[model samples]
Target: MATHKRAETLMDSVCEDMEEKPEPYFSFGIIADIQYADIDNGYNFMKTRMRYYRNSLTLLKEAVQEWDSESTKPKFILQLGDIIDGFNVPQKTSDTSLAIILAEMEKLKIPFHHIWGNHEFYNFKRKYLMESKLNSKPLEDEIGQLTINEDTSETRSDQESFYGYHFSPYPGFRFLLIDCYDLSVIGRDTMSIKYGMSLKLLKEKNPNEDLNSPRGLEEEQFVQFNGGVSGAQLNWINSVLASSDEQDEKVVVIGHLPIHLDSTDAICLAWNYKEILSALQSHPCVIGYFAGHDHDGGYSVDASGIHHITFKGVIETPPENQAFGTMYMYEDKMVLKGRGLVLSKTLHYRNGRKEEPVH
Candidate 1:
């Protein structure tokens, strides 16, 4: 908790020094948890967080306009998932909700790389999502030259999309997009192996019949709203990390669910995050992890040099406010230029274990 606070305190001062920093190698815009719907604003099930379902689309529109007007225009935009609210389906606005959000996103003309969140399951099934536009398919001029001879990543396979694909915008640097919900109960048929596995895990960790409730559970990650990384996906992550290591490239992982306990509430983490976190920490090439699930965002650099940033949720922002930013990737550090509620932070150490303070 002290590390988290100290990071934020430094972020408050870092923005003013941006003019003095070296030129960034590349830049990209980031926004998450738009969670838009056609319904009016309402409180969450626990009533601790109020969601502005309708106004989030407007926020996206403004964010799009802001990004479109930027001189350096991001190489690509990372839509960190939960693009539409879960309530949209029960509210009978799933189709229209998605259409409007996509329309707003289309205005930017930049490639959007999306992460799959649990709210997405509330709106659409996994089969549909496999071929959806939300999947971050690498675009040529935007992402660098293809390194792989054969396409074996997420978008190519219609049956299942456990993509551990790398988006190389700059040489020796990659954004590894991971699928955290590959083994989840949400949107999966009850009889499916993945679904069974998720159920068994949840039952063991959480006693509540209302699976979403994390009440008595010591480890809150067992809730139904969260998911896990499958064994296949873990292997893929390792393979991609090995490939990136061989190529001498540094990687920044992008996903929906937060993997670090300190980076987010236990309720918002992946079930098998310990395993996933171990994989990232052990890999010297893996420098950072970006995600959104906890509406109240968090930041913390682990004992390892990896920087974990859970972006603030768009839906959590009031209609009058917004949460978005542009991330500038410098050779030695990454700087996030926040627009509204998102704070600008300098994650300085990318590769070595010699941890540095947030600037």
Candidate 2:
């Protein structure tokens, strides 16, 4: 009996050691659509509940504090856009609201990347915003060492901001940040070439003279508010993905607009989502696509086995409630650990593999 008990104890010890082995290559913090402002709570255009514009500031602060306390801190934080809301009195209050949010993010003392969204453009022009908020800066620490392959050959019509960029954090992985609003009306002047193109495109598709209205558009995606990836940007994405594939690296594509119908409202999708999907399908190395804009959030696995994850909007959370997440990337899977309203999900690589849940 004593000999048998000793053997069982030894077996248990080995199993525990195996279970404790670390698998995640790295992790990062993700939050979306904080949409912070000093205005009073109000309903969305469709009467959907939008609560506590000021409270989002507190929510962001909590997220920053929580990330700061983690033992294995995130390599960086990705703010999925809309730092301020469209209703924030434009230039008068927009800059102040943005400053408040930026101050909170700065408390994290880590590299944080950003993208543009419709609401951002409502507050500032592309040139001003690029010069102020989206200016390219080196990330801090080892995370900053991840180099971006900038395509210098392609130039914007008016030296406008190019929000798309790629970074390789480690040997086997790359992150692609796409500017989904490349052809949107909000950021460009009436006389700008891109703005004219957007107007013409909307006029052709949407019969509603109020371009923002979807009443007369047959397809939900035909709304003027959503934008598409430009030809130049699409080429850049193709080049990046192709190069990454050659390096045997997997990619995670991040954007402010949803690229998949399963992961967002039909109306909130990018105008050229189908084309984007086709591009993604051709790239076997893309493991996941993360996005924000559909407030409620969702997840779906495409036929190509790429995971589409839409983060819950912080603005939609009720007063005192919170929404955010941290993503852990591993050899064969990625785990999104949710906080507050966000739902946790484990996305495996191709072949339908499974792994231990992220706690």
Candidate 3:
């Protein structure tokens, strides 16, 4: 595959004839549930997690270096979600774990986008039930927001602690980073007076059957509750795709969990066949979809022509949290090259047209 250049002339030509324009390709690092945390000293989980970060970072460093040499490296990095396992742990501890992982990532020198998984939702109750101090209006009207610093450190204020759901500037491309963890559709800074009504209902009724067990909820219920990239997110995605179509540019979608897994039986349905297939059918410019959830790596493309990729785990040992290599986009395809202490270019993807080992 030829490495497409992003020079103004090429971009202009591509923009002029999107159909004729060979698909624009990018190489980015995708991983989920790094769940960086200090486990019980006696437990082997922490030891394995520590190694995952070390090895994954090592591979990422190499990929970034190679791309950096080319004028067009990656537009940025995408972390599907679960950067850390326990969102409710003491903020101090979470901060320390995050710092360790993010600090290492800073060396890459590219914007890192993240999504908020269920584990990241901590103050959902209080923030919704609180009084108004941050704003004159009640909390329900406010939108949750969280900013992931370039260094990978996260600072969240309850008023708007929604993480990593934002826009990135790209020529002919619009990128939306959503914080899927924030389940409530309303804001939380104002007193329960406004948005608290729903919070109260949820507390009393507990709509989520698995509120007690984070891992127990069915994928379908999860998606029905907060899975599909619809509502504000769907609207945002549609608008971006529309804009791209009007300009005749390629539009790419990224999320922590694939649309398939986001709304079905996580184990049974390896991919979101219906919803994703439909979306791609409707939006043709949507050239690719990248996600990380199932620790083991896998890839699938539906009849509608959408590619779904699940990268390997970073932690490669034990009952959970195994080690895995990183995936990158090369030319018109995405590449999954081996990383960590172990090395093999066994896993990866090409553009929408090809499978792993893009070459």
Candidate 4:
């Protein structure tokens, strides 16, 4: 029920000045954790939160209609993963559910990017995901295939089963779409190398037989529901950031798991988030990271001055409410045109870090 109340209040205050806000250089739609399923609504784990499984589809439709009505439509849209719920597979409605949602996004007729989350692995296997549209390998018209330093290719293959890629919409702005579950237990087959790695780590870190339970764990990240990036993926990201630095480009990091511990509950954090945060801090070209997975949502500005935003999940939003926004980027600030649970805000950044808030 509580959605990071303090941070939400602070962000709402920062976003209150949109009345005199200047024209943005670019605008992009933002939505996350749709987790859509055709089944009746139900409660979340621990039965502590209600989820509107059926109503989420309607919420997405509302968001699209709002985006279409905008005077200046977003150049693109970002769907921060969990487009469909894991329960869809058990009920045998996964394909239909996914298509119904994708159809709405297609109506916008603009490019959109997808980042992978744990739930995606719940429904689809690694091989299937590689061939799926969720791979961030959009067409040339939707998203151009940029050269991500180190000769990393976007070609679909069993070898590159994970969905980590970088693209530059404009010459000076780059988007790093990370595959947070690159090393996880659910997506790859139990016999796969990645799965073995995940199981080994989970066994070593979590003593509970129920790997998903975070009980009695000092660092709750060992839970099976969360995942992490492998060294190979990390190296690739380093290369991309290195290239960004050389080109004097500013990067906006996008992922499904909330990496900054302060910006998300410990249980919802990724496995190797400290390493991920360290990697991000090393790159002065990075401005912020956007994510989902934590239903209540969260916000924090790390020591390096990077913004970490965990958007509220559409499923957890009450049946009568919605969660989405359009981020308007300016020379010195990023403004939020939020609807429903998302708060509107004008966050200012200087040399890759945000201005310290005056208490």
* Model 3, TM vs. native: 0.56
Q: List model 2 lDDT by residue over 226-320, tens digit each.
A: 88887778877888787766667789899888888888888888888988988876777788888888888988878788888899999989866
Q: Which lDDT tens digits does candidate 1 get at residues 250-344?
A: 88999899988778877899888888988887677888999998889998888787899999999989878889999998878888999788999
Ranking by lDDT: 4, 1, 2, 3
lDDT of each: 0.81, 0.80, 0.44, 0.83
- How high is each candidate's TM-score? 0.87, 0.90, 0.56, 0.88
Lowest-scoring 10 consecutive residues by lDDT in candidate 2? 350-359
Q: What is candidate 4's lDDT per residue for 248-340, written digit by digit as tens?
A: 777889999999988899999989998888888888888889999998998887877778889999999987787999998877778888899
Ten contiguous residues minimizing lDDT sum, candidate 1: 140-149
Per-residue lDDT tens digits of candidate 3, residues 2-66?
Answer: 44555766878877897643544545555555655555312222243323433434444444565
RMSD in angstroms, all models?
8.0, 4.7, 11.5, 8.4
lDDT value for candidate 2?
A: 0.80
Worst 10 residues of 4 by lDDT: 139-148
Of the candidates shown, which would achieve the greatest TM-score relative to the real structure? Answer: 2
lDDT, model 1: 0.81
TM-score-wise, the better of 3 and 4 is 4
Which parts of model 4 are misplaced by more than 4 Å? Answer: 1-21, 139-160, 352-359
